[model samples]
Structure formats: C-alpha cells, structure tokens
Target: MPPIHLLDLSFQETAEAIAAFVVETDEGPVLVETGPHSTWPHLEGALHKLGYRPEDVRQVLLTHIHLDHAGAAWAFAKKGAVIHVHPVGAPHLAHPDKLLHSARRIYQDQMDTLWGQMEPIAESQLHTPADGEEIEIGGVVFRALYTPGHATHHIAWQVGADVFTGDVGGVRIPGGVVMPPCPPPDIHIEHWLESIARIKQAGAERLWLTHFGPVDEPVPHLDALAARLLDWANWMRPWFESGTPPEEVTPRFQQYVQEQLRSEGITDPQVLQRYELANPAWMSVWGLMRYWKKKLARG
Candidate 1:
C-alpha cells in the first residue's frame, strides 16, 4: 500500500479544516483532492514541501465536483494531468459556466476570494468513470463508488482498505464528533443513508475525509454520522411543515449546532465559526427543508 500524506490547505488560517491527500505510488504521485482554487498556493507549497511540483501530478481523482473538492482540477488538467470524475460531473467541469453561475449565486461577491478562478477542463482530458469502475493510476487501484446524498455526482474512492470519502461520509474536526454537511441543491437523505451502508460494506479500515484527516474508526464514525444526519433531517421536517421562513430557521439551526459543539467541548466562537463554514448550519437547513418538500410533493 502507498503511503498517504495529508496536505493542510490551512483554510482561513485554521489548521486541519481542509486537507488534500498525496499518495506516493509506484508509478508516481497522485493527488486525491485539490482543496479549492483559492488555496492553490497553499497546495503548491504543500507539494513543494513533499518535493513535488504541479506538473509532477499526472492523475487527479475527485470524490465529487464540488468547488472545495475539484475546483482546482483544471489547474492540473492544464498541466496535462487527466482528471477522473463521475459521469454526472464531467460535463460540468468541461463547461463550468453553469456550475460557476450557481455557486456565484450562493457565494456572491466572495466567489473569487473564497474559490478563486475556476477554469474549464478540456473534455478530452476528462475521464468519467462509472460506478463500480476500477481505475489504476501510478500502480494504485482506485474503485469509484457512486455515493449520492450530499451531491448526485459524488463518488467515494476505495483504495485497498482505505476510502477517500469527499462529503458523503460527513465532516469531523480533530475531535471525534461527526457532523453531517447537508448542503443544498442536492441532499437526499434516503440516498445518503444507502451510501453510508455501501461504504460500511466496503470494509474499509479508514476513511479519508476531504474536510480533515483520516478517521481510523470507520464503523463508529459512520454510524455517528448516520444518526446525526437523521437527527438533523427530522429536526428540520417540522420546521419545513410549519412554513417557517429560511431566515429564521437558519439561526435556530445554528444554535442547535453550536450546542452540539459545546457539548463536545468545543465552545470557542472562532472554532464554532470554522465548523459552520466547513458545514454551514444554514445550508443544512435549506437541504433538509428541500428534502422534505420534495418528499411531500411526491406523496
């Protein structure tokens, strides 16, 4: 097995908040996630520290096409690296206008500052792998498992006994508390729960989250995340039925998350803010609310 090195992106000057993994394989080095384009410099510095250059990366595997995970993939694609992603996400990367437009509506003026420039990757360089597909790069075999819930295009990469779970497995800071990152536009609770079961059945020993580092206790971590997801979704179901404005729900959800963090011995305002940024309470509110609304419509 190749050694996986964690590269700290140092997001917002906070440690362990966002990370990219470097896998040293027999053929060469492969980068798992690129963090975000805004943090490309930090990624470059990390690569430099590991004695690698931008061009040194010949293959880049993405768990999803979310900005935080695959925003900088174009940078590597420009360096002649083949960008492998889910079929659902390949078109968006090839033509990023719609993707950027949607994100701009959410990020507004903070777009450039928060995500940096997102360039379009040539379709020729994009490889859309099917679910259950196995891709071997640099003598490393990665199995792409379609894990939808957080995002329809999301894929969890399984390498030997380890899995690179983008956002499908949820977020956890250094502390051992698991929190669901239920961002909107695509948050299917049923699908997500199924995805969690899929990951557990994979028998991975560890889960490498893009938000932070490796989680050694896979089963327990995933179980906690599943429970947290249902708890949050159930909490929002009533709020959705009541037709409470999103504005009010956002703050209430924030308080709820803050309380959870406090109980876990994380009370600092700054730390709480970092966790919020990683997985915003407002986004979860919107996501859960949307999920319920859609279910209700179907029923």
Candidate 2:
C-alpha cells in the first residue's frame, strides 16, 4: 500500500491556500499537516472522501507549528488526534499566544482571512519528537529529521523514498521547481544547508512538499535550491554589512531574486508570484540579513 494519500485541501487555487498530506498507517490514518482552521471543513471533507472519519485519523504529525502547517491541529486534537511536533514548537502550540502575536505582527488584519484561527493543543496530546528518532504508527515508520532553517522547530519526515519536507526544502511550485522560503526569525544559512544535507543523507528518492505534491527529481531540484539559497545569502550579506536601511534593502533584494528566478528558467511572472506567495522573496532578504546581524552582534 502507498504510505500516504494527498488530500487536496482545495486551497491551491484559492488565495493564501496550501496542500496537506495524510499518511494512512496500520494503527490509523496520520495527517502530516493541518492547514488553517478555516479550511478545516474542506480538510474533513477530503478525509471523508478518502473514506475515513475524523476519529480514524488518530494522530497528527506536524513538521512544525507554523500556522499553515499546524493551525487546524487543535481542531483535530479536540476530536482526539494525537499531536506530534518539534519540542521547541510544542510550547507555542500548547499556548498559541506567542504564535498568534508573531503572526499578527507580520500579517496584522489579514490573520483571519489569510490563516484561520489557531487553536491550542492539549499538553497531553502533544508529542515532541527528538532528532533522529523513529516513530512507528501501525507499522509505518516515520523518522524525524531535525531540519531547522525555515524555523528553529522545523522537522522533515521520512518514510522510505518519500520525505515530507515542510519548508526545509523550500516550496516546490506547480511546475515542480524548488525555491527557498527564508522567512524571518529563524532563517539561518548554515543550519538550512545542514538540514538539506540531513535530508539527502536520509536517502529519499522523492521529496513531498507541504505546499504541494511529490517531487521526483530530488537531486537537481535540491541542487538548484541550494545554489539559490547560497546566492541569496551572498547577495544579502553585503547589504547587511553596509548597514543599509531595511526599507531600502528589501526592494533591492526582490529585484535581484526575481532576476535569479528568471535566470533559472522560471519564465512566467505569475509563477514567480506563486513562489513569492509561498515563500516571499522579501522575507528571504530580511531573514538572512537579520541572521547576519545577529551573528555579527554575538561576535
């Protein structure tokens, strides 16, 4: 049997929408990510169409507690889905005040429209996966790779040749091209590369992205992604070193990034927009620059 089933959350065409994966295990069905709560009905509908009731989904595996990935987790946990997330992320999911506040800072009034309500998970249901740990649910093995660069709490799930890379491998758009999602507060170039190496070491033949579906050619996609990440880091380092105003730096970075995408064969502007929506180019500029500043300050 296939290890997992793709639940098309119908958010793909909708604005601010994303995909979610459901892994059917021997014990029960395990959902890899819970999109925002507003999409909960759609998710439930998808699950039902797949022939399983909500309770049949006994466990929810989160690559991280980012709202898009884990927002609807609370709704499931309320229905008795055991929540699994990173240790660092467990607290935030258990008490969503910080998560909400941080998202509010970034998204402001668009919160409800962009990402639905984030409900709190009960402490008892929260399972903080350790690095290199293998979890077997109903005989299906899922090894958690502590891939932190997208976020300090991020994890990538591996099951045979298919690995569910949350944001660690970046977002693979409709055409299957990979792009880095260097969002703020937790984007570190060193750690992001390390995470990529970790995923490669795990030996997944295909990478399943949370933003969409399976990527068959892992090597070239990953190669392109790595080069772009480095290029972005290198491009932003000088700006940070020069202490350019954040206002001036962001727009400059976007142009450079857009040009890089064009060089890499992404010809369509709307395709670029999708990439921007999934992992805003501006955030990459901010995240790397901020990381550089923090690293320098520490020294």
Per-residue error (Å), model 1, residue 230: 0.3
Question: What C-alpha lDDT values do all the predictions have?
Answer: 0.90, 0.82
TM-score of each: 0.98, 0.93
Tell me the number of clashing residue pairs for each predicted model.
Answer: 0, 1
Give the per-residue lDDT digits (tens) of candidate 1, residues 1-299: 88999999987667778889999987788999998899999999999999999999999999888888999999999999999999999999999999999999999999998898988999999999988999887688999999999999999999999999999989987763789998888899999999999999999999998877899989999999999999999999999999999889999998898888888888766666667668878888888898999889999
Clashing pairs in 1: none
Cα RMSD (angstroms) for every candidate in the order listed: 1.1, 1.9
lDDT of 2 by residue, 1-299 (tens): 45678776655445323778888777878899888776777888889988888778888889988777888898888888788899999999899999999899988998887778887788999998889899888888888889988899999999888899998877877753677877788888888888888888888799888776778878777787798788778888889999887679888878877776777788776667677767776677778888888888888
- Whole-model lDDT, model 1: 0.90
The candidate that wins on TM-score is 1
Measured by lDDT, the strongest candidate is 1
